[model samples]
Target: MALKPSQPLRLFAEHLREQRINLTERWMKAVFNDADLTESDRLTYEQLADHVPAILEELCSALEDQDLDQVEPSIERNAKLHGRLRWKQGYRIDELVRELDLLRQVLLGAIFGYAEQYPAFTRRHEERARYFIDEAISFVTLTSIREVMTERDRKIDEYTGRLERANHELLLKQKLVGELYESRMQLTRSVVHDLRNFLNVFSMALQMIARAPARTDTALALANRQVGDMKTLVDELVEYSIVLGDTNAFATEAIDLRALFDELVAACVPTVEAKGLRLVQRFDRELGTVVSNRLKLKQIALNLLSNAAKYTKVGEVEFDMHVCGESQWCLRVSDTGVGIGAADQERVFKEFERANHEDVPGVGLGLAIVRELCRTLHGDLRFASHEGEGTTFEIIFPLRLDTDG
Candidate 1:
């Protein structure tokens, strides 16, 4: 059932109709002056006043007829459009509510002003106008907020879907990397295994030829040395492959630094003396035990010592160990070898890279392996060298290795 308005209510509605343009102008002025409605400032007059005139017409019709049902459809449509436009203009929900409340206040103030101007419009007409304005603004505020929330939810879903797809792609790439690494390890093992079998046959043939009557000792010796160099290369390839594939390879235990140095020096002495170079050692007797990967430390030390002995012609190769800090230690290998040139120093640690020494027998996995092993053991390797003088390689290791690291 539709409720009818009194004659004064109809007159008030007609008065509002006459002042619709003025009312809209007043509302626009309020929005522009409001600090909280700053988003309206970015809009042109048409954009800021979007659907407001239509909303005012609906409000007047509902006031005249006193039938909210008749005006609801148009009010809802206009209010939804206003909400979406304000959202597009970067209005916050609070700002939207504040702007609409201002509209309600403007209409009520106009009603009170009209009642004061005319003797026929009493307090009853003013109260009726207030009731209708409250009803319409409530509906508009609800509908507008629902639209803004719907748009916000839709955007949230869109961003969530993008994040999910990105995570899936990252997982796929990680799986591909794992598969490629395994394939490489398999290939390296197969190739190294076959090469070792062939090398064994060549080594046996060289031994047999050395025993023959027509054997040239110099040529046989050279052949034997070449065979030995090939074996060393194969061994380095295996070690490099293992280090690359296994991150959990550093199985740690407590090691006596003095004992480890003594053993390493003893092993390196035979090779250093064979090259007619003196082997020198300096150890800190007070050097106590350290918790680290003994095998990796041994490999790094041996590689540096061997390189020192292999390059030095007349001068000594020094192996030194000392306490570098309160909880750190340094193992330094220095030699009067043909030192690396400044240009080649940067490329020295790269795989299969040798520093300006083509005639030197090396497949160049030595420093590369050393670097990887140093990192695995939580150590830092640094070197200083001059062209004619020598190279000194120092590795600083923590006194106590952290297993988790």
Candidate 2:
């Protein structure tokens, strides 16, 4: 066989092919630290750093051609993707430009450092390599700027549309101020009324505790219950604001659902037994590991189970789980307690409204919180209730196979 030309170009290309993955990882770590980039609430590393592999491969291909012209496709794709992500994450144009400048420097440094080890490489080869990367970086910068501007224009268009819609609504409602003012006043009065009711409960419970001696324990327990109610009111207020303000504040991880359920059941058993009720767990299928925000899931489960235990005075409270479908799982809690009436079904979901308006110590925020949480999990929160019979709350969390993403 005839001997093929074993030039520096072949050596460089081989290095890229062999070291592409390891090099990409190193590049990402460097970029992550060097740029002070916060990884959360932004595009993941896979999304953010997707273009690096293609760029490396293209550079290897370019070595054979003795030019950088063939690298345009990868560069353009990279620029657009990066620009889109930066725009989403609120990165300034200058910051993105600086990052690209640093990336180009780092990549060139690695390539040049490798070249320096080869005694056969000449200054002319070094200059050619520098020129090639410099041109490529310039192209990347231009494409990035163009894509960012495009995204900016898109956001502006969306804002304009929203404003126009608001203006249209205003024009329609201009003559309806009397109705709007009356509604606002009613809402204000309702809020004030609810606040006063809660305050009255607290104040009366404290008075009873102070006056009674023979019934001291009972009065103290009532007072403590009122304190818990006040704390729940405050917690619900905070949680409602947080859940409404930014649903993306938390992250999810893979966890064994069965393990979590076991913990919950064990914790709830004491309370259920104390209430003279039986706690029953029914597993329809094996609960494999699932991807979810553990704290939030715990909150959801705790609320449901606690509510079930709290309400069920006579019969057993049951917790059920099963694989509902190919990608969905269902968790349900049922209590044979004082159930919800049809009249209050819609009212209960409203802020500060309770199903057991007369006897329940809660501010009616649990179901509301559960509903908001279920929405975040890409799941549903629903219940079936018959007054004086029983109630069941089912929450379904769909499987996300792409955990660690």
Candidate 3:
């Protein structure tokens, strides 16, 4: 007997069941082509499409029989499975929903493909086919939402517990911290105050040794240089401790920019030579000193030079000083080194941050200290660098030294 003509919805639904394999294949291909969905390490076809065939049979059966009881339970089970699996795979709900939409498109394209084979599929047939697919979407998404909400509630509960514990511990510790902070402040001030007096003694002893008749040329020069460097370090420690407690701690004095630059260059030479790198110092003779904390200025200059020498391996490190306006001067340190990447440049000034992966050592505190010291002096610090090219740092500030040139 010849086949009887039927409604288009029933016919298309039957066609979908018959072409379920083709539909699944097309859906998988569509998913693989999607860059967002093709992360197989996280979401493989086996995980995403395991229930596709059953999904098609049940959904098409619903369209054919007009009964949802047969399909709803299966779709709900599969939807819950997908929700848990995708969450484990690190998929956000938005990405999962996106792929589901793509699956719908691919399946609809399969329906259009069937239209060419069966003349009974009109646009009305497309609408009916969509109604069945739409029902499937609603069921799957409802179950998915339920599962996700369940997971979210569990996470919220766990995090709430952790937060409650942390708050309790913090409350207990704050009292002890309050007591220790005062004691620490007192001890630090006492220690640093005593240390400053020793630096003054060290200065006197170096001068005495430099004038002693028994002192050899080489030994006297070495002792004087070592004492100067040690004084710089000691003064730095004392001022740093004082500044940490009070930003207005360091005393300002009459300093000559020319003579200070010469002394700093001499102090930094041994460190540069140890690294087997050339250190060039250029200064404008007219850039007379300004009234500033001489020790703090020396610390900033030496810190920059040390960083330049630390990062640059083969190429020369240069320090340039010049008078900008009548009362402004610039100190620039440039290095031919492995320059900072763009991602790290902004954060390099943050405390304890390294700009590159190179084996360059240090706790990443230098730039942060440079920035803090610059703020103390009301100076402008800026940098320009390319990844492979060199980096240049310029510290520009008003003159604060004696007018005696």
Candidate 4:
């Protein structure tokens, strides 16, 4: 009842596969704690592991008998016999091979003894064992091929996932491009309309001057003033477009807040006086120079001040330059003016959107431009207002004090 030494090498390997499967499954479960492994996968490995003993026994017997007949029952021989094994199967190799070598020697000794004791009966059993061993060797070869196929399939899956993600991003980019193109067309139409109106007015002013030569002086001056206003509007529109398009629009520069505020107040003092509004200025000496885009920051401040002046009929317009939160410079502008409504506050920053007001005059781009400029400088703008009481706009910017000489 012993295996023989004359068994095929195929049987020796099958015996190893059986022992390896069991040891691997046990070790892997202990180490991994069974993370994400499906029941089917587990069952497959378990079945393979359980069959390890039979596989190894056959291998040993085949090797001893030198017939290779027992090799047919190996894991590789029958394609439909088992499901896919988990990656953990590789762990069982050492132990299985060790046990298999021992079995081979034992069976080999049995074979020599059987041949010596009963040469007549040995031939028939040897032939059967040889057939089994041959099948088992084929099965073992198939298992290795299966492992290779599994690896290839895994790589393919990874590639497919990456391709899907890339396609999603590409679609988003295409949508954005379409939206931008439409916005550009709208902007172009607006520019052309404004230009046509400006030219028409210029033509009418020229005709009026030609008709009355004596009154031409006054008419020309008024016409020139209108043209100047038109030019200012055109400049603002162009600047806004450039700022929005360029990612690197804000060039950092060191500026003194006190000096900047003084200059802004001086520039707007004539308008403030014309409106009969009191201007109050307060500067904190401790607030030092901050590094930012000086022009953009000035544009924001000027817009807020102009908005305040436009809305206010009589009260005081207050400007305060001070340190707000920790290491942040803040410019607060308060005006006792006809303030913004709660319903319209959120939409004020959108392009070409103005609150419903009878007295105010603008294309509704001032606040939008202000917000964009603030964003470019890595700052934020916020406001609080009441319809009849007053309005306050706050600009908060991180203080990056220049240290390099």
Tell me the whole-model lDDT of each prediction, alpha carbons only: 0.86, 0.75, 0.74, 0.66
Q: List the residue pairs that clash in candidate 3.
A: 257-289, 289-401, 290-400, 290-401, 291-400, 291-401
- lDDT (Cα, tens digit) per residue for candidate 3, span 151-220: 7788889999999999999987997798668646754664465456546656665666768757555555
Global Cα RMSD, each model: 13.1, 18.1, 18.9, 11.5
Best by TM-score: 4
lDDT of 2 by residue, 1-405 (tens): 532443666666677678888777776666677645554226577865656677667777666566676667877887788678777778778867766776677667767777778755556666666666677777877888889999999999999999999999997798578776774575467557766776787677677777866677776777677677667777777776677677355677887888888988998999899989988898765668887788778878888888887777799999987888888888899999999899988877666667754665666667767887787777778889999899999987787633334
Number of backbone collisions per candidate: 0, 0, 6, 35
lDDT of 2 at 40: 22
Candidate 4: worst 10 consecutive residues by lDDT? Answer: 79-88
Per residue, candidate 1 scores C-alpha lDDT tens digits across 343-400 of 9899788666778776777777889889988988889899998888999999999999
**Candidate 4 structure quality by residue, lDDT tens digits, 1-405:** 655544433443444344444434444343334333333243444453444444555565555555454455453443223223323343233333332333334334444444556554356655554455445544554564565466557867989999999999999999989977876776677667767877887777788889988878877887896688587777778768776887753457788888898999997788888999999989999897888777877888888888888889989898888987777988898999888899988887866667778566665678878888777776768889998888999888888733231
Q: What's the CA RMSD of model 3 in angstroms?
A: 18.9
**Which parts of model 3 are misplaced by more than 4 Å?**
1-243, 401-405
Better of 1 and 4 by TM-score: 4
User: Which is better, 3 or 4, measured by lDDT?
Assistant: 3
